[model samples]
Target: MWWYTFAHVVYHLIRWFPKNNRLKIRIVIVLFSFGLLFPQLFVLSREHSTRYCGQHLFDFLIVSIVFTFFMIGFSFIFSLMDPVPWEVKLAFHIFGVIAFVMGLTLTVFASLAVDCRNNTLELYYLSVSAAVLTVTSFAFLMVMIPFWLLNYFFPNSVLNRKERTGVCYEPTACCSCLWHI
Candidate 1:
Protein backbone atom coordinates (compact mmCIF):
# COMPACT_ATOMS: atom_id res chain seq x y z
CA MET A 1 0.00 0.00 0.00
CA TRP A 2 2.79 2.41 0.87
CA TRP A 3 4.57 1.42 -2.32
CA TYR A 4 1.46 2.09 -4.36
CA THR A 5 0.91 5.45 -2.72
CA PHE A 6 4.53 6.39 -3.37
CA ALA A 7 4.36 5.25 -7.00
CA HIS A 8 1.22 7.24 -7.66
CA VAL A 9 2.69 10.39 -6.11
CA VAL A 10 6.03 10.03 -7.88
CA TYR A 11 4.39 9.39 -11.24
CA HIS A 12 2.61 12.71 -11.09
CA LEU A 13 5.49 14.71 -9.65
CA ILE A 14 7.85 13.51 -12.36
CA ARG A 15 5.33 13.46 -15.20
CA TRP A 16 6.30 16.70 -16.85
CA PHE A 17 9.64 15.18 -17.59
CA PRO A 18 10.36 12.11 -19.72
CA LYS A 19 9.20 8.89 -18.14
CA ASN A 20 12.07 6.78 -16.93
CA ASN A 21 10.05 4.16 -15.11
CA ARG A 22 13.23 2.50 -13.93
CA LEU A 23 14.52 5.72 -12.46
CA LYS A 24 11.17 6.29 -10.77
CA ILE A 25 11.35 2.82 -9.26
CA ARG A 26 14.91 3.46 -8.12
CA ILE A 27 13.96 6.75 -6.53
CA VAL A 28 11.01 5.25 -4.66
CA ILE A 29 13.18 2.38 -3.46
CA VAL A 30 15.75 4.86 -2.22
CA LEU A 31 13.09 6.97 -0.53
CA PHE A 32 11.52 4.04 1.27
CA SER A 33 14.91 2.64 2.14
CA PHE A 34 16.04 5.77 3.92
CA GLY A 35 12.66 7.09 5.00
CA LEU A 36 10.63 4.13 6.16
CA LEU A 37 12.42 0.79 6.26
CA PHE A 38 15.75 1.91 7.69
CA PRO A 39 14.25 3.73 10.64
CA GLN A 40 11.80 0.99 11.49
CA LEU A 41 14.58 -1.57 11.36
CA PHE A 42 16.82 0.66 13.46
CA VAL A 43 14.27 1.05 16.23
CA LEU A 44 13.17 -2.59 16.23
CA SER A 45 16.65 -3.98 16.29
CA ARG A 46 18.16 -1.58 18.80
CA GLU A 47 16.97 -2.77 22.26
CA HIS A 48 14.87 0.33 23.03
CA SER A 49 17.55 2.55 24.48
CA THR A 50 16.14 5.78 25.92
CA ARG A 51 19.27 7.83 25.62
CA TYR A 52 19.00 10.84 23.29
CA CYS A 53 22.33 10.09 21.65
CA GLY A 54 21.07 6.61 21.02
CA GLN A 55 17.91 8.14 19.49
CA HIS A 56 14.71 6.85 21.04
CA LEU A 57 11.94 5.54 18.81
CA PHE A 58 10.35 8.96 18.50
CA ASP A 59 13.64 10.47 17.47
CA PHE A 60 14.00 7.77 14.84
CA LEU A 61 10.61 8.77 13.46
CA ILE A 62 11.78 12.36 13.18
CA VAL A 63 15.00 11.28 11.57
CA SER A 64 13.03 9.14 9.13
CA ILE A 65 10.99 12.09 7.98
CA VAL A 66 14.13 14.19 7.67
CA PHE A 67 15.74 11.51 5.56
CA THR A 68 12.65 11.27 3.36
CA PHE A 69 12.99 14.96 2.53
CA PHE A 70 16.64 14.44 1.73
CA MET A 71 15.81 11.57 -0.58
CA ILE A 72 13.13 13.57 -2.37
CA GLY A 73 15.41 16.57 -2.73
CA PHE A 74 18.22 14.46 -4.16
CA SER A 75 15.90 12.58 -6.51
CA PHE A 76 14.54 15.85 -7.85
CA ILE A 77 18.05 17.07 -8.43
CA PHE A 78 18.93 13.90 -10.29
CA SER A 79 15.80 14.06 -12.43
CA LEU A 80 17.02 17.36 -13.81
CA MET A 81 19.93 15.75 -15.64
CA ASP A 82 20.01 16.20 -19.46
CA PRO A 83 16.54 17.75 -19.50
CA VAL A 84 17.26 21.05 -17.81
CA PRO A 85 20.20 23.28 -18.84
CA TRP A 86 23.55 22.73 -17.15
CA GLU A 87 23.70 26.01 -15.23
CA VAL A 88 20.20 25.57 -13.82
CA LYS A 89 20.81 21.92 -12.98
CA LEU A 90 24.10 22.66 -11.28
CA ALA A 91 22.57 25.51 -9.30
CA PHE A 92 19.65 23.38 -8.14
CA HIS A 93 21.93 20.46 -7.24
CA ILE A 94 24.08 22.72 -5.07
CA PHE A 95 21.02 24.15 -3.37
CA GLY A 96 19.60 20.68 -2.84
CA VAL A 97 22.85 19.56 -1.21
CA ILE A 98 22.86 22.56 1.11
CA ALA A 99 19.25 21.99 2.09
CA PHE A 100 19.80 18.27 2.74
CA VAL A 101 22.80 18.94 4.95
CA MET A 102 21.10 21.72 6.90
CA GLY A 103 18.01 19.63 7.56
CA LEU A 104 20.00 16.54 8.61
CA THR A 105 22.27 18.61 10.83
CA LEU A 106 19.37 20.27 12.58
CA THR A 107 17.44 17.04 13.06
CA VAL A 108 20.53 15.21 14.38
CA PHE A 109 21.21 18.06 16.77
CA ALA A 110 17.64 17.89 18.04
CA SER A 111 17.87 14.14 18.51
CA LEU A 112 21.12 14.50 20.44
CA ALA A 113 20.10 17.49 22.52
CA VAL A 114 16.74 15.99 23.46
CA ASP A 115 18.18 14.81 26.78
CA CYS A 116 19.33 18.29 27.75
CA ARG A 117 17.70 20.09 30.67
CA ASN A 118 16.50 22.85 28.33
CA ASN A 119 14.72 20.30 26.18
CA THR A 120 11.24 21.76 26.14
CA LEU A 121 12.34 24.29 23.57
CA GLU A 122 14.14 21.64 21.58
CA LEU A 123 11.18 19.29 21.48
CA TYR A 124 8.88 22.15 20.58
CA TYR A 125 11.09 23.11 17.68
CA LEU A 126 11.32 19.51 16.54
CA SER A 127 7.54 19.15 16.67
CA VAL A 128 7.12 22.26 14.57
CA SER A 129 9.72 20.94 12.16
CA ALA A 130 8.00 17.58 11.97
CA ALA A 131 4.62 19.17 11.36
CA VAL A 132 5.99 21.36 8.58
CA LEU A 133 7.70 18.41 6.89
CA THR A 134 4.59 16.27 7.31
CA VAL A 135 2.52 18.69 5.31
CA THR A 136 5.16 19.55 2.75
CA SER A 137 6.11 15.93 2.13
CA PHE A 138 2.48 14.93 1.60
CA ALA A 139 1.92 17.93 -0.64
CA PHE A 140 5.03 17.19 -2.64
CA LEU A 141 4.12 13.51 -2.79
CA MET A 142 0.84 14.53 -4.33
CA VAL A 143 2.94 16.66 -6.64
CA MET A 144 4.91 13.53 -7.43
CA ILE A 145 1.91 11.56 -8.61
CA PRO A 146 0.19 10.81 -11.84
CA PHE A 147 0.65 12.66 -14.89
CA TRP A 148 1.39 8.87 -15.33
CA LEU A 149 -1.50 7.56 -17.40
CA LEU A 150 -1.91 10.89 -19.08
CA ASN A 151 0.00 10.64 -22.39
CA TYR A 152 0.88 14.29 -22.93
CA PHE A 153 3.20 13.99 -20.00
CA PHE A 154 5.08 11.06 -21.49
CA PRO A 155 7.69 11.20 -24.21
CA ASN A 156 6.73 7.73 -25.50
CA SER A 157 3.41 5.95 -25.78
CA VAL A 158 1.97 3.86 -23.00
CA LEU A 159 2.14 0.14 -23.66
CA ASN A 160 -0.96 -1.90 -24.50
CA ARG A 161 -2.05 -4.75 -22.21
CA LYS A 162 -0.92 -7.38 -24.69
CA GLU A 163 2.41 -5.65 -25.13
CA ARG A 164 3.22 -5.95 -21.41
CA THR A 165 3.93 -9.03 -19.30
CA GLY A 166 0.98 -11.15 -18.20
CA VAL A 167 -0.10 -11.14 -14.56
CA CYS A 168 0.82 -14.28 -12.70
CA TYR A 169 -1.46 -15.81 -10.08
CA GLU A 170 0.00 -17.29 -6.92
CA PRO A 171 -0.31 -21.06 -6.34
CA THR A 172 -1.14 -20.20 -2.71
CA ALA A 173 -4.54 -18.95 -3.86
CA CYS A 174 -5.74 -22.63 -4.03
CA CYS A 175 -4.48 -23.36 -0.49
CA SER A 176 -6.72 -20.58 0.87
CA CYS A 177 -9.71 -22.40 -0.67
CA LEU A 178 -9.08 -25.35 1.66
CA TRP A 179 -9.72 -23.13 4.69
CA HIS A 180 -13.04 -21.73 3.49
CA ILE A 181 -15.93 -22.52 5.85
Candidate 2:
Protein backbone atom coordinates (compact mmCIF):
# COMPACT_ATOMS: atom_id res chain seq x y z
CA MET A 1 0.00 0.00 0.00
CA TRP A 2 2.78 2.39 0.91
CA TRP A 3 4.60 1.52 -2.31
CA TYR A 4 1.46 2.24 -4.28
CA THR A 5 1.10 5.64 -2.61
CA PHE A 6 4.74 6.45 -3.20
CA ALA A 7 4.41 5.52 -6.86
CA HIS A 8 1.46 7.91 -7.16
CA VAL A 9 3.47 10.82 -5.74
CA VAL A 10 6.36 10.10 -8.04
CA TYR A 11 4.04 9.84 -11.02
CA HIS A 12 2.50 13.22 -10.16
CA LEU A 13 5.91 14.87 -9.93
CA ILE A 14 6.93 13.44 -13.28
CA ARG A 15 3.74 14.72 -14.88
CA TRP A 16 4.62 18.27 -13.87
CA PHE A 17 6.99 18.43 -16.79
CA PRO A 18 5.98 19.18 -20.40
CA LYS A 19 2.17 19.30 -20.65
CA ASN A 20 -0.22 19.26 -17.69
CA ASN A 21 -2.19 16.36 -19.19
CA ARG A 22 0.21 14.05 -17.41
CA LEU A 23 -1.25 15.26 -14.14
CA LYS A 24 -4.69 13.98 -15.02
CA ILE A 25 -3.20 10.66 -16.03
CA ARG A 26 -1.39 10.53 -12.72
CA ILE A 27 -4.64 11.25 -10.88
CA VAL A 28 -6.24 8.25 -12.53
CA ILE A 29 -3.22 6.19 -11.58
CA VAL A 30 -3.51 7.26 -7.97
CA LEU A 31 -7.20 6.50 -7.81
CA PHE A 32 -6.59 3.09 -9.35
CA SER A 33 -3.99 2.37 -6.70
CA PHE A 34 -6.43 3.49 -4.03
CA GLY A 35 -8.89 0.98 -5.43
CA LEU A 36 -6.26 -1.70 -5.00
CA LEU A 37 -5.63 -0.79 -1.34
CA PHE A 38 -9.31 -0.60 -0.46
CA PRO A 39 -9.94 -4.32 0.00
CA GLN A 40 -7.31 -4.49 2.74
CA LEU A 41 -9.14 -1.92 4.82
CA PHE A 42 -12.06 -4.35 5.05
CA VAL A 43 -9.78 -6.59 7.07
CA LEU A 44 -9.67 -3.80 9.65
CA SER A 45 -13.44 -3.49 9.61
CA ARG A 46 -13.89 -7.26 9.92
CA GLU A 47 -13.27 -7.02 13.64
CA HIS A 48 -16.31 -4.80 14.01
CA SER A 49 -18.88 -6.71 11.90
CA THR A 50 -21.14 -7.33 14.85
CA ARG A 51 -21.86 -3.61 14.74
CA TYR A 52 -23.66 -4.17 11.42
CA CYS A 53 -22.50 -4.57 7.86
CA GLY A 54 -24.00 -1.19 7.10
CA GLN A 55 -21.46 0.42 9.37
CA HIS A 56 -18.61 -1.10 7.43
CA LEU A 57 -20.26 -0.14 4.17
CA PHE A 58 -20.64 3.44 5.38
CA ASP A 59 -17.01 3.62 6.38
CA PHE A 60 -15.93 2.23 3.04
CA LEU A 61 -18.10 4.69 1.16
CA ILE A 62 -16.85 7.65 3.15
CA VAL A 63 -13.21 6.76 2.66
CA SER A 64 -13.69 6.10 -1.04
CA ILE A 65 -15.47 9.41 -1.54
CA VAL A 66 -12.78 11.31 0.32
CA PHE A 67 -10.03 9.71 -1.72
CA THR A 68 -11.91 10.32 -4.97
CA PHE A 69 -12.23 14.00 -4.15
CA PHE A 70 -8.54 14.20 -3.39
CA MET A 71 -7.71 12.63 -6.72
CA ILE A 72 -9.94 15.09 -8.58
CA GLY A 73 -8.54 18.01 -6.59
CA PHE A 74 -5.02 17.07 -7.59
CA SER A 75 -6.13 16.87 -11.21
CA PHE A 76 -7.63 20.35 -10.93
CA ILE A 77 -4.38 21.72 -9.55
CA PHE A 78 -2.52 20.12 -12.44
CA SER A 79 -4.86 21.81 -14.91
CA LEU A 80 -3.57 25.14 -13.62
CA MET A 81 -0.20 24.29 -15.05
CA ASP A 82 0.70 24.26 -18.79
CA PRO A 83 -2.28 24.26 -21.07
CA VAL A 84 -3.22 20.93 -22.60
CA PRO A 85 -5.67 19.85 -25.28
CA TRP A 86 -9.19 19.61 -23.93
CA GLU A 87 -9.78 16.21 -25.53
CA VAL A 88 -6.80 14.68 -23.77
CA LYS A 89 -7.84 16.15 -20.46
CA LEU A 90 -11.40 15.02 -20.98
CA ALA A 91 -10.26 11.49 -21.78
CA PHE A 92 -8.35 11.33 -18.52
CA HIS A 93 -11.29 12.73 -16.54
CA ILE A 94 -13.74 10.28 -18.05
CA PHE A 95 -11.54 7.27 -17.40
CA GLY A 96 -10.85 8.49 -13.86
CA VAL A 97 -14.51 9.10 -13.11
CA ILE A 98 -15.48 5.63 -14.27
CA ALA A 99 -12.60 3.98 -12.43
CA PHE A 100 -13.45 5.84 -9.22
CA VAL A 101 -17.11 4.87 -9.37
CA MET A 102 -16.37 1.22 -10.11
CA GLY A 103 -13.77 1.15 -7.36
CA LEU A 104 -16.23 2.52 -4.80
CA THR A 105 -18.88 0.06 -5.83
CA LEU A 106 -16.58 -2.92 -5.68
CA THR A 107 -15.20 -1.85 -2.32
CA VAL A 108 -18.65 -1.47 -0.78
CA PHE A 109 -19.65 -4.93 -1.96
CA ALA A 110 -16.36 -6.38 -0.72
CA SER A 111 -16.79 -4.78 2.68
CA LEU A 112 -20.29 -6.15 2.94
CA ALA A 113 -18.97 -9.59 2.09
CA VAL A 114 -16.37 -9.38 4.81
CA ASP A 115 -18.85 -8.11 7.38
CA CYS A 116 -21.08 -11.12 6.80
CA ARG A 117 -20.73 -14.16 9.06
CA ASN A 118 -18.12 -16.73 8.15
CA ASN A 119 -20.11 -19.59 6.65
CA THR A 120 -20.00 -21.53 3.40
CA LEU A 121 -22.32 -19.10 1.69
CA GLU A 122 -20.45 -16.05 2.97
CA LEU A 123 -17.08 -17.59 2.11
CA TYR A 124 -18.15 -18.19 -1.46
CA TYR A 125 -19.27 -14.59 -1.81
CA LEU A 126 -16.07 -13.31 -0.22
CA SER A 127 -13.94 -15.42 -2.51
CA VAL A 128 -15.72 -14.22 -5.61
CA SER A 129 -15.50 -10.59 -4.53
CA ALA A 130 -11.84 -10.95 -3.67
CA ALA A 131 -11.09 -12.55 -7.01
CA VAL A 132 -12.75 -9.76 -8.96
CA LEU A 133 -11.08 -6.94 -7.06
CA THR A 134 -7.69 -8.65 -7.16
CA VAL A 135 -7.86 -9.26 -10.89
CA THR A 136 -8.93 -5.72 -11.68
CA SER A 137 -6.33 -4.23 -9.40
CA PHE A 138 -3.59 -6.38 -10.86
CA ALA A 139 -4.55 -5.43 -14.42
CA PHE A 140 -4.34 -1.75 -13.59
CA LEU A 141 -1.02 -2.19 -11.85
CA MET A 142 0.35 -4.16 -14.78
CA VAL A 143 -0.35 -1.28 -17.14
CA MET A 144 0.83 1.37 -14.70
CA ILE A 145 4.17 -0.26 -13.91
CA PRO A 146 5.24 -0.47 -17.55
CA PHE A 147 4.05 3.06 -18.31
CA TRP A 148 5.99 4.41 -15.33
CA LEU A 149 9.13 2.52 -16.25
CA LEU A 150 9.02 3.73 -19.85
CA ASN A 151 8.81 7.32 -18.67
CA TYR A 152 11.48 6.89 -16.01
CA PHE A 153 14.20 5.42 -18.20
CA PHE A 154 13.67 7.74 -21.12
CA PRO A 155 12.35 10.89 -19.47
CA ASN A 156 13.05 13.10 -22.47
CA SER A 157 11.15 10.84 -24.80
CA VAL A 158 8.07 10.56 -22.61
CA LEU A 159 8.17 13.94 -20.88
CA ASN A 160 8.70 17.47 -22.14
CA ARG A 161 10.24 20.14 -19.90
CA LYS A 162 8.97 23.73 -20.04
CA GLU A 163 10.65 25.80 -22.69
CA ARG A 164 12.99 28.48 -21.29
CA THR A 165 11.73 32.00 -21.82
CA GLY A 166 13.37 33.94 -24.70
CA VAL A 167 15.15 30.79 -25.86
CA CYS A 168 12.90 29.16 -28.46
CA TYR A 169 11.54 32.33 -30.11
CA GLU A 170 13.50 34.54 -32.52
CA PRO A 171 15.22 37.63 -31.05
CA THR A 172 13.04 39.97 -33.16
CA ALA A 173 9.93 38.53 -31.49
CA CYS A 174 11.25 39.39 -28.05
CA CYS A 175 9.97 42.18 -25.74
CA SER A 176 13.23 43.97 -26.58
CA CYS A 177 11.71 44.81 -29.98
CA LEU A 178 8.91 46.87 -28.31
CA TRP A 179 11.45 48.52 -26.00
CA HIS A 180 13.44 49.74 -29.03
CA ILE A 181 10.27 51.29 -30.55
> What TM-score would each prediction reach against the true structure?
0.28, 0.34
- Tell me the deviation in Å of residue 82 in model 1: 12
lDDT at residue 10 of model 1 (Cα atoms): 43
lDDT of 2: 0.47
List, residue by residue over 131-177, the lDDT tens digit for candidate 2. Answer: 36545665666656664566667653333324433322344354433
Q: Relative to the unseen true structure, what is the C-alpha lDDT of residue 28 in candidate 2, on a scale of 0 to 100? A: 62
The segments of candidate 2 whose C-alpha lies over 4 angstroms from its true place after superposition are 1-51, 83-138, 156-181
With a 3 Å backbone cut-off (N, CA, C), the pairs that clash in candidate 2 are 18-160
Q: Give a tens-digit lDDT track for model 1, residues 1-181.
A: 1222333344345544455555765566466545644544444344433334433434644554555554455455444443556785465446445544544445555455544424343343443454455445445535433423333455223322344321111222434221110
What's the CA error at residue 133 for candidate 1, in Å?
5.2
| Alpha-carbon lDDT, every model | 0.44, 0.47
Candidate 1 residues lying further than 4 Å off, grouped into runs, are 1-83, 115-181
RMSD of 1: 15.2
